[model samples]
Target: MKKYLLSIFTLIIPIITFAQDSTAEKFDAVFKEYTGWFVEGIFAEIPFTDDIQIPWVLFVLVGGALFFTIYFKFINITGFKTAVKVVQGKYEDIEKHGVDKLYGDQTPGGNVFETIKDDGADGEVSHFQALTAALSATVGLGNIAGVAVALSIGGPGATFWMIVAGLLGMASKFAECTLGVKYRDVGEDGTVYGGPMYYLSKGLKEKGAGGVGKVLAAIFAIFVIGGSFGGGNMFQANQAAAQFTKLFGLTGDNAGMYFGIVMAALVAVVIIGGIKRIASVTEKVVPFMAGIYVLAALIILFANFTLIDDAFALIFEGAFSGLGIAGGLIGVMIQGVRRGAFSNEAGVGSAAIAHSAVRTKYPASEGIVALLEPFVDTVVICTMTALVIIITNFGGDSSAISGTFMQYGVEVKEGVEITATAFDTVIPHFSIVLTIAVILFAFSTMISWSYYGMQGWAYLFGKGKITDLIYKILFLFFVVVGASISLGAVIDFSDAMIFAMVVPNIIGVVMLSPLIRKELKKYMNAINKKEDALEDGATDLVDEM
Candidate 1:
């Protein structure tokens, strides 16, 4: 750890030496041009018609999600109660402590000894912590801002489709996270190295596709690393800094530089402790941040109690009719599906990395717990944002276009502010609160992404202590850089990089989905057996009494 602290200087000295006048200006231009080209190529949309187009990645995300939903027999709905129980530790004896006399110090096919010695509690965090860690990554701007953007273009009808997409996404999360834990490696020191990289290579290799799996794993690692830096860390920092600077009446792009540095320092403190620390922070911070946002949305919702029915009516009617929306029903559906899939990132597979650290013997148990991510993030929190917008009708009138696309004296990136204005309609001066929420959202997002990028970095660079140090230094540097600069293209490229992960991840998940099903069955059977054992023990006790 001393070596880790000292390594900060390794990055700092070079930045200081190069912090001259025109150098920063020259480098910014070069970075934007290079990233812009990548963004254009990666995010180029498939032209469905003159007025409507969608990215192929969105198709992969939504389609794979739908397929998983059906393929799993609506596990997202049926297994939801099981998922809640798993998080609440209802099956603790089944997963951790063994069920005595079930199979000669055994259970679950008489492998209790092996299960306890080899796999019992091989993880670093609790089910709740793993869920929160993953949730912290997805529950930020997407729920608050992206939902608003979808509603702005697609109208109230988009909310219906959004809920549908989020439901489908729940199954995708389950499949990938199950595969994540099944193929994960737990070190002698109890550190976990898992995610799509492991599952693609290990799980697919088990299916005799070693070459394809390795290539896919490598692609996933590269994309995740780039995404962690760009979309997950830098883009989040940039947006939060923007909102903070604006709300506080600060001027200049560099006005947020100091703010960025402070935020970076805070992130550095948390991430330096690794995933356990990250999970610990997230388990607290995620609920708090989400609670505050949800509570405010609830206030607006209940205050306009009369508009609730009208809001749902608009959502249902607009979703099917889309009369005022260009390209009709398809456009509204596309926007809602896009926002839903992107918000919770069900098929993107980053959540699997966080969920892989859960303390469980059965891979499918963690997978069940993982499915709740989309439920809380998209279905619940995002729906709150959508309802607030629909109820307020762009926070002004019952019109389609509220000039929000042109408001705020800037281009239509009014996601955070738009949601803020909706809340302010009832709460008054809630923008200050909203700004703090955005900053906290960004801060939590960056810390989790740092852990994600570190995992990817370890996959590529090998698992030495230096790997953690080097990744931390670079991550912290980007946090400051993101806040200090204004590079739309760079941010866009990063967003594309994040979506790029969907390709290899979903391919792996689909290929290994059969194994996922078997694992799920294995887990459920054990759950049943455990329940039977408890019932037998209870009957024996009553008889003895």
Candidate 2:
């Protein structure tokens, strides 16, 4: 693995040397040209008639979310208390050990592969670590950069739709992750390898659709690898590189390439250590980074408290009347839903991969815990970021484009830097601090996504040191290329790939949702009646004790 990584970096060093004499624009143009077709095809509009069209992925995501919301009876809302308690370890005793008298006591799967068995739970990481690791992936650029891009394109009206999408997404996230935990494979050495690839294949197989599940699983694995490269890896590098270069005025064709190399080197260190290492790092880093960014956002919001109502007024008014918008009503909706999906990734199924590693006996427990991601990510963090930008008039003069989001004086190229600019308005040189947060955000996201993509790669190629090395090499290569590309190409590809995971993921989840509902029903039943159940399990506990 080390030799392969070294060889790969050796090949890329020329690009850095070659870039010295060229302009960055040329790199962007070539990237856009080659990959443009994939982007166009994925985002192609499906017409409703002569005048109206929407990306069909939006329907897949929203439709599945709505179905889940209803089918599960709004588990996203009702499971809140359980989710909190589960994360706080209120149910750790039962989750780790056993409640033999419960609704349906699941025997831990760790015994299946005794080639190696670790002590404790069947799963690898704690619930909190799983949540933060997953949170690290979804929270960063989408909240900081993607939201900025959405507002710039969709206007304030998009904020309303963003919140709506986030709410509906909670249900989608719950179903996918519940199935993830239910169908996961615990390996001999205690390593976890699961995700949409596992659930779609395993869950559907149990539903008597084995052949269909196999095909869907393969497609999902391929899409996840691609999605990780674009949305999870490249888009992150692009934004971080853009912000880093802009802050220090680092000009030249290779500025982004130089930044990408450094980031890739840093990322290589942690990913080589695998999920446990990744989890340990993220638990500490994610909170500190998120706190710093959120605290800054809160301060800005308080300083401009008077504009809160007005900002919201614009959001609501723009949602209904997109008069100055490009695609008008539908355009605003697309941006909102797209960014919301991109931001919190409720239906994307990536969280299922991370959440699968959580140490819990009940599948629904992790799923319940997983629902908080969209609320915290999209509803809380993303909303705060949006409010700050809107309150500061951060996108620029709304009338500049004769009523578009073409904010005068704002540089869209910098992506996440725009958020920093909004912060700097209330606090001087805040972009400097923001640059640090962006780097950390990008770093955390890249590491988590590396694990996700690795899972998919292992699904397709079969897991081993060689397969892992090959995937890591390929992944790091994209990180560099992603940084050097133009924002439009990078973002278009990123959005297309990430949302594409929704296809297979949503199909399997919706079909398998009944099982998830039962899982939720059983888990909640056990939780609500734990006292009596625990009393009955005293015999089992006595043996272990």
Q: Specify the highest-TM-score model's number.
A: 1
Q: How far out, in Å, is residue 537 in model 2?
A: 13
Local distance difference test, each candidate: 0.83, 0.81
Tens digits of per-residue lDDT, candidate 2, 1-545, equal 67767788889878656644445567667878998997887778889656458877778888888999998888888888778988998777667654433223426752332232333458888899999999999878778887888888777778889998898889988999999899999888888898999988888888899999999999888888887888789878987887788778999877888788888888888898888889998999989988988899999999999989888888888788774777778777888887887688888899999999988778999999999989888988888998988887733454322222336223265456667777888999888888888889988999999999999999999988889988988888878877875556656776677777888888899889889989988777767666665556632231121
Q: After best superposition, candidate 1 residue 346: deviation in angstroms?
A: 0.8
lDDT of 1 by residue, 176-225 (tens): 99988989888879999999999999988999999999999999999999
Candidate 1, run of 10 with poorest lDDT = 536-545
The clash count of every prediction, one per candidate, is: 1, 2
What's each prediction's TM-score?
Answer: 0.91, 0.87
Model 2 lDDT on a 0 to 1 scale = 0.81
Deviating ranges (above 4 Å) for candidate 2: 1-7, 15-37, 48-52, 101-120, 323-330, 394-417, 484-491, 532-545
